[model samples]
Target: MAQNRDDDANDGSNGTSNRTSGIINSGRRGLMQGAGLGAALSLLGGVSGAGGLISTAQAAEAAFPQHKKWKIVFVNHVTTNPFFVPTQYGIQDACAMFGMDYQWTGSATSDAGEMVRAVNSAIAAKADAIAVPIVDPNAFDKPIQAALDAGIPVFAYNADAPRGKSNPRLAYIGQDLYLSGYQMGERIASLVDSGMVALFIATPGQLNIQPRLDGASDAIKKSGKKIDIQTVATGATVNEELSKIKSFYLGHQDLKGMFAVDAGSTQGVAQVMKESGLPSKGVHGGGFDLLPQTIQLIHEGFLDFTIDQQPYVQGFYTVMEAFVFLASGGLVGPANINTGLKFVTKDTVEPYLNTSTRYEGKTTKPQIVPMKGAIKS
Candidate 1:
């Protein structure tokens, strides 16, 4: 499978490419020209060019030079999910770029308690920084505060605490899940005309996906259409999700649309839609994230579209924010970073399927692909 290539490509090995080596050498040369060998060597932590495209070593004379390899602990809600594979790669890339280490630990089953425990453990360890997806609104509030009190910088990624909630996490580095879902709901309203729509969510009431479900529901309802929205829960496992989706389709043969809020559930929706030939029957479907299967299925006309929340940046930016906060000694306070949401449909999935790189969680080999045509938004 394509994902197997992705997994093998990014097996956490520090294998350097010629391109990266060249970039590093260039950065080192620049440092040497500006300072003596000792100074340059000291500055040799990590360097980068515009857009962080060129991997460089760190500057030794950094503003916050403790000589200690700051470790960032990332507590995940679903650590093993393919949707987060690119995210983990992002964290890895950022850590390497910034001369830091990171640990990925959390519940593979999306258990909030397990995630909370991971956060608490990071605090107890007095980690340099902590990054987590605030999957549960209240469960993370106190633990996050504890981390803050312990002097460990905490940042939210992918999922965040709900708005107006006094969770004292410094900032959020992810897409606005609710607004994205609301826009998606508006998209669905444009496509489907007042029929039963089945929206599948892997887990409900979890902040990671609940807001999306709520937003989509609200938007569809606000459309003032007689669209019947029936939500079904697809279990954690991909197999279970697929089975549930198929079962739901079998029961609701007249479903006008099938949508999902998560990656596994989204793929399940596509599989069932393809198997049932729902698109031919004028049934619409789409959801968030770009699972390889989800992209391929969209290309094949089985699925209509998928939203790209840029999962890679969720991790990348979280680490970046944490580094800035730690480096600036709280002078650079954290801010909510919306990673952005984009719609990928048949017309735009070509690049995704054709390219393989860490940016999309596809490959570890870091070579820039040259673009030929004018870009369209």
Candidate 2:
């Protein structure tokens, strides 16, 4: 039977659909149904829109056809990563909205080898599409190419290809890492000219973060900010990372600022700065993502600012983009989605802090104001 997803989308928005007979079954939390090679591809061409079927409120209401069902596997770096929670929400909601099948599985710990294995497993399982964060450029080349050779559509999200145009993945969906880093660096250089400042990375070799360190260095040099930059490799565990940073700060009491690239490390970096009692001094700090704790730290004046990459949007759009590629027999790569690198200071953090959704890991109700009484955002 040909299925329509519109009703489910409407129901999701208005909270009303009761029918369980359609292709748009929001009730089916998670299920994988094998699709014929070509049958699965048909659903990717959503109705009446160049953007995927879930592009608008109306389009999202339509369902994936029973005959057009496709399964996708999202192999994330951190399955339990609070940062990707919004992204997971995006993937789950988008699939539910489109009536597609998807499974998100990955290494709980961030390991390139585990991610590659997960992608290979999905390929062996014959998933229609595979989305992954190719954080390590060299490590992912073979696995990504293999997925493409096997007819599974591969996409890079959250992280990007450092060596651009080198990988065969279909598309990338995330912030322009280098540019965002450049912007952050420009700001840091504007604040202070000469001092020993450090840029920290959670995974040293990971391409996404390394570029930020590069951008900061370039920007600092360009600004003529004789800033002594230290590129520190902090392991992912938050407390342990925080302890290492604190030890560094204690030894280098004359340090100026510390900029962080990864999400988990931001909070740790903020903590170390706060305890150092250098708020009045030239100790300024900034980080990449807006983890809840990071936002709270900013609000409390323990940190300067953090970035907002809009992870949910990243997850949602990447899947939808891959779906578009599959269903339309078209291709979607080099897709530009904003991470909304919002610089949240004490003044700006509070507005975003009231979010009910556990942005790093949970679902949320859209905050909507009725047209009759609404003031525009």
- Which candidate tops lDDT? 1
240: Cα error in model 2, Å? 2.0
How high a TM-score does candidate 1 get? Answer: 0.87
lDDT of 2 at 207: 70
Q: In terms of TM-score, which candidate is strongest? A: 1
* 1-377 per-residue lDDT for model 2 (tens digits): 01121331222221111111244553332121134325534443654464442333334433333335567788877665556656766776667555566777766667888888888898888988888888876878898889888888888888878854488887788887887788889988987778898788877767767777777778888897588888887776666668778778888889889879888777778888777766678788988786667788788887888877788788778767776666556532335565656666787665567644524442344433233333323
* Model 1 agreement with the true structure over 249-339: per-residue lDDT tens digits: 9998988999999988999999888888889999999998898889999999999899999988888778777766666668765789999
RMSD of each: 6.0, 9.1
In candidate 1, which residue pairs clash? 42-60, 43-59, 43-60, 45-57, 45-58, 46-56, 46-57, 46-58, 47-56, 47-57
* Number of clashing pairs per prediction, in order: 10, 12
Which lDDT values do the candidates have, in the order given?
0.79, 0.69
Give the poorly placed runs of model 2, Cα more than 4 Å off. 1-23, 26-67, 331-340, 358-377
